[model samples]
Target: MKCWCGKVLIIDTRRLESKFRDDGKDGLIEGVNLKDRIERNMNASSYPFRVDDSCHIFRFTSTGMKTIEKVVVFDPLPIPGIYMLVLGDFDEDEIDVGVKSNNRDLEMVLSTVVKIIAFFLSDYPDASIFVEGSSAARNRLYRIMIEKERKNWRELFVIKGIDEDTFEVFQSGKNYSSYLISLCKT
Candidate 1:
């Protein structure tokens, strides 16, 4: 599928296991890193896609402010799959989410990921592109931002569950999300 963001993309969200590797002195694949193979086809002649494997933690300035206010760098995880699992926060009311996704075609996935991110770019946006076993699924959730719903929407992230915790994090975020992470195994 192709998006009007001057890029063409494709997603093949197939459940696959790969050797997990990270940035360290010794190069080794410790355990099997689960992945959903989603490929993005970029038509742009030159696009910068070197910003992968970086985690951004969005912290709020206020106690109950929606959306991401501040972003911070955090420790990199060994795993790759996009785990939206919730961890207890320093403050009980606050919630912390760690995001990471295993990459097969890094450029394509990241490019397409930028488009999928548009879904959360609005004040009240409801849409999701998911990877479900070798295919991309698009669910027109709530009121859409764009006039017409995306017909050729592609999957950028392969997720496990759309639980309440995950929903809360996404919904609470303003225009950007701190829970999103892009990881690369070097």
Candidate 2:
């Protein structure tokens, strides 16, 4: 299947299923160094998270001025090995990506999302994750965060920025409409 960035992805479903079954025996797939995933200098504090049976959804809570529930979903795209990283507030059994929580914990919330990404990649190392903000402002926020930690993340991930039908290696000063990230082949 062709991803939005025009890259073709061919996945082996049987291999993925077998790997999942083997690693999920304990109800969790392990293989990432969570402590090293985020930069310490960035105030990268995170909340505890819970994962659903399928491991596609992760839930956590944000606390500051007010308590707000949040969820990160790894929704699979039509292509087998491609997934979208969705971050949103969980409200009344629905996910509202555009909701402004006003919780005053953007760093912590983003840290939690990064941790979730680490966990998800541990299970599907070869899979590509697509990320785009719900709005232009949010997109800028994401770009800023990525720029701040680009060097720190380079060892673990291959990050590509999408600009109008072109995908290029992520650069600090360049702005991108979206991003694609995958585990770096060792």
User: Which one is best on TM-score?
Assistant: 2
Clash pairs, model 2 backbone: none
Single out the weakest 10-residue window by summed lDDT for candidate 1. 134-143
Local distance difference test, per candidate?
0.25, 0.73
Q: Which tens-of-lDDT digit does each residue in 71-185 have in candidate 1?
A: 2223324444333312112222222332222222323332333332332222112223222121111121111211122222223222223332543323321222223322211
For candidate 2, the lDDT comes to 0.73
Backbone collision count in every prediction? 8, 0
| Per-residue lDDT of model 2, residues 49-143, tens digit only | 66656878777779978888787889889988989998887565445777878788887787678777867886788888999987778878888
- In order of appearance, the predictions have TM-scores of 0.19, 0.76
